[model samples]
Target: MAAALAAAAAAAAHHHRLSSSSPAARTRVVHHHHRRRRSSSLSFSAPASSHGCPRGARALRRAAAGDGGGNGSGGVSTGTVDPAAASSPSSSLEELYRSCATWTWRGMRVNYLVRGEGPPLLLVHGFGASVGHWRRNIGVLSESYTVYAIDLLGFGASDKPPGFSYTMETWAELILDFLDEVVRRPTVLVGNSVGSLACVIAAADSSRDLVRGLVLLNCSGGMNNKAIVDDWRIKLLLPLLWLIDFLLKQRRIASALFERVKDRSNLKDILLSVYGNKDAVDDELVEIIRGPADGEGALDAFVSTVTGPPGPSPIALMPAVAARSPVLVLWGDRDPFTPIDGPVGRYFSALPSELPNVTLHMLEGVGHCPHDDRPDLVHAKLLPWLDTLPSTTALTPVSSPAA
Candidate 1:
């Protein structure tokens, strides 16, 4: 894996804008891409595939789930719903919530579902998403490892309390708390987009050994567009960013904008912008993103996230993560938000060359959400890494520390 990643990083570095002039500079660029931003934008809508998809929710039911080291897969999306966009997946998720349990943190409810058997693996979703977003992958992942997927605060069924900061740090702290109170052991954290950032922070947490491994899919450059360099990228986005921020301050404008974003047609268009594979942007997927927006604090969550801090950059956090867990990075080659050849993607693709323990895969033709877009492809790459890890059975359980 190291050799493959080193070669991949070397290849990515050669084609990337931040390619190293010297051998040593190669390692430094992984750290640099996190600091600098270039161009990024939502693309126009692409047509969805008409091919039939197997019922993921149904398949989940067939899989054996529980953490007794059994060979099976399963999980539930333990949370409430806003009732706007209902589907089989949503019904199953709500059932999971009914069957499992929830956590109350600082007066906010966090819903989570766990299944299968092996080392614990927690799944966190990106912005405007929830545990339901992971419907395709969780059951399969549970087969080999115990899987825990949660609706982060302010998203999904989780409470979005008024006056909450909703910053990256806030989310990261939430992950840490979940680890301490729920998992009660060092677990592998798999995150996509902003969820990856929170996991990065959780892995770096020194208060307790919370995370033992990481899987980042299309990890975000920062929490917002402001992460871009002051050059062309920033210049182009500044005006729009300012306009959006200005409008969000007013409830009426914010509601109007939110409505547009929530539109099913616009939702498909938004997915096409970052999803390399148009076929993955199906009715179910759109509904997953849509339902949460109807949840009570969804609008507030969006406003705070857009205006909040970008959070700790990989440059600030990667080194520490590198020092601890072996990292697996899977990037969608077609992701507009962080293209494989783009500056941010360059940093990520070049990661393995600098940090030998980290392995990077640029999933061809995949987009921002590879796990959801092409779960089979993701599983093929992910399973081998899981095979290489030490047995979770040999490890002693770490008790949750006092808060």
Candidate 2:
């Protein structure tokens, strides 16, 4: 009986071992199999959980892994938050300003300041200036329209890539790209001095539909015979003009040149305030301005613009632009660039005898930058014109000029 019992006990022990070692008896056999298969081959299957584990438990494990065990909800845990989502809207705007977009057409990175919400309006600054030049007008204009004041590549906090020549055509192309990509809508282009010339050129080009209307401040490209009479001092200093131009090419030198102006303190403060506020003005902005001012490429650009090949003059482009869009010529009665002393009626007469849509407004006691010098006067004329246009339709004239 004892021998039989011993044999029976041994058999029972063997059975127990077989049952425990079998694949069906192993608690994690399926998980092990899946892991091995996943390890050996490429698959996009959802991971398998340990045996007897609930779906909630598996999710908790994943959350813990992702969140490092600190509040493991897994829906954008605070510990693993995205930096972009964390940034404020104002911070994003600052980022945009610091890193202006570049258009390949002209190897210039145009710096633009965008503000407010409404129809689009593009503000272009004069020679040797940047977007900061429109500091006074941006805030007010933003109330009525989405305002975009841009630094024409070489002038502002933009990249002055070497070997690139700054011409009206190149600058106009950059403006066109900014209008199409950045603004993403038709725009009312308002330009001052040389900027006005660029606006006329851009508006004249029929291919671009973004430029819907134009507001020319101290409109250039017209007869400036009065500039000769009023700027007698400039003519007297003509011999030193090239040297002055060369010196102004450097930011530091340009700053010093302004020191000789009658109102040096006010002018310097204004320039510094615009280019760089006391807090922001640093070596970087100085370096950016210096590159275009002192470099050979910038010098070539300046020389070309100041005394370069003339395209169809402003008078020529005016008719074409007027045919496409209503033109509003806003002149500063005291404009130093294009004085109002000349026979103004005769100048207008030289162009199409009559532009039924074109209107001229003379702002009193303003200078070259009427938008800056007289924002109220500019607003007075601008708001009414904008009001006349349909809410959904941009004011683009349909007529085309004969070549």
**How many residue pairs clash in all the candidates, one count each?**
4, 0
Best by TM-score: 1
Q: Show pairs that collide, candidate 2.
A: none
lDDT of 2 by residue, 1-403 (tens): 1111112222333333332332311111111111101011112122211112211233433432342321111111122323232111112223335433333323234456666667778888876556655654665555556777777765655555443445666667667666655565778899987788788888886385777788777665521221232245446544444444454344443333222321334333333433211322333333333433543334334433443333435766776788888666666665544556643323543333367556666655555566555454555565655555545454244322111
What lDDT tens digits, residue by residue, belong to model 1 across residues 211-232? 7789898887677655644336
- True-structure lDDT of candidate 1: 0.63
Q: Return the TM-score for candidate 2, rounded to 2 decimals.
A: 0.56
Cα-based lDDT for every prediction:
0.63, 0.49
Cα lDDT, model 2, residue 338: 57
TM-score of 1: 0.74
